[model samples]
Target: MDEPLVRWDWIARNWDNGSPLAIRTLLENHVVMAFAPVLFGLLLALPIGLACARWRLLYQPATAVMNIVYAMPSLALFSILLSVTGLTQTTVIIPLTLFSLAVLIPAVVDGMTSVPDHVRQSAVAMGFRPLRRLLQVELPIATPVVLAGVRVATVASISLVSVGALIGQGGLGALFTDGWQRQFYTPIIVGIALIVLLAVGADLVLIALQRLLTPWSRARRSA
Candidate 1:
């Protein structure tokens, strides 16, 4: 029998009861695997970035290592982790989290550094301790830039999380691979479309969120 040319009509029909299970499965896997690791990276990267920016020695080696991790191909990173952990969720999460560090760290450092030195001096003059200055003053001013970093990291993680399917983590990428094995294109096309949709949707949401979080940014925007 000739292969069916996968089209929107075929996709629309399958999207009903036929593929709802697959969609849900993929979405659940995508959300858990993507968010957990990416969030971990952001949490780690932000503090480290702040510390390094405050103390330059830490920035050199930390930035260098993060850049190395960022440069690593996802497949290569997965293969290395798979050798150590053997095809499990760790193989996905560990590498994805590490991969997010480059974007996250730079974002954090930039945000913290963007706090004018005069502001830092004023906070010191007011007797705010170092940590207090950072928490109450610097970070508040830098929230938008830091959130933008998170936006970038999360978007990147969402796109790359599909690679987890290679280790049986079962994301939308799993559907894409499954379609490839079965010689069906619908699942592959649909999976890619869903990923694109998720990325664009998440970016918009994050942008709105950043705006909401940093009200001072609005004045700057208008100025």
Candidate 2:
């Protein structure tokens, strides 16, 4: 007899099995693996992006390096990282961080450049120092664009983290490999559902944050 597409019993059994293989554990791992890189990338990208925007000469070379890093195959990068980090989560995080930088650096540069020259001049006229202007004026104006890039990087990272399952470091991605090996559909379906849920939930939260932080942008759009 053929098996049904999903096994409720299997889900119930593993939902909180108190093991690393449990669904809840995998979900937690997935969230950490997916989000940590974006956070780190943003922090790093801010300075790099600022430099690139401030000195347009650096933008081309920086972007070229990032693009090359992004184009490298994830599996190849994982294999290379394994020698240093072993089968640890760091192996996954390092490469994903690089990929996040690839997306985020450009976003940061664009957002910074989007600040109008007049606005910058006005800041100078208002006795704002360079650092103060960046923090209090330019960055606020650039929030919407930067957050847009963050949204893309976040969703992409969530989906890409599953690829790490090939090396036993994948979060929810382990479910995919497990189900495939066992010929069971339950874990695979559950993983997909959870990943989708996570991505959508994250995206909605970011959209809400963007609205909250950049009310003027929203109001301008509505008008």
Candidate 3:
């Protein structure tokens, strides 16, 4: 505890001007590294997920493949990518993108499927074209469930980005390696604590966003 305090103090003292390892830079890096992949993955998976929802045949196979990829060890995944992408951020981002896609795809499917059958029938009765209904009706109705999946992806991305430190690109994870190398406990503890805080903070922010966007969901809850 005291050690972490000392580290935090050191971090604060250097906060304003700590070159590459500045706490601010690290925090920003952590957020960027973690979120970039998730955003990319989510975008990629949204259509894929929707397709699966439409075509049941694609659903199970896609889920199975993603699950297999997700089951692979993170380090092994990184190492394998390293062989091709080398030490660039691409190595880190690609794996994480796949991971985020795995988490988001099922959630997207769930969200889409959760739109009650009656809702779809009503949309069809109202002359809502397929595209418009999907864009306006389905997406809005599915927002809460989709957001829940996004929360999972976000948290997983944040936690896994630390593993990048192994390949010299870990954001907040770099501090952990540095601390261990120097036999210091502060950076390690601080890194872990901050990572958890970051994950929780992001999750809470997403939850708030979900509430703000889905007024109908709140209305339903109140009723």
Quote the RMSD, in angstroms, for model 1.
Answer: 2.8
Residue 210, model 2: lDDT of: 93
lDDT of 3 by residue, 98-154 (tens): 999998999999999999999999999999999999999998998898899999999
Tens-digit per-residue lDDT, 102-121, candidate 2: 99999999998889999999
Off by over 4 Å in 3: 1-5, 218-220
Q: Candidate 2 — which pairs collide?
A: none
Candidate 1 regions with alpha-carbon error over 4 angstroms? 1-21, 218-220
Against the hidden true structure, what lDDT does model 3 obtain? Answer: 0.89
Q: How does each model score on lDDT? A: 0.82, 0.94, 0.89
lDDT of 2 at 95: 94
Instruction: Output the TM-score of candidate 1.
Output: 0.88
Superposition-based RMSD of candidate 2 using all C-alpha atoms, in angstroms: 1.2
Pairs with steric clashes in candidate 1 = none
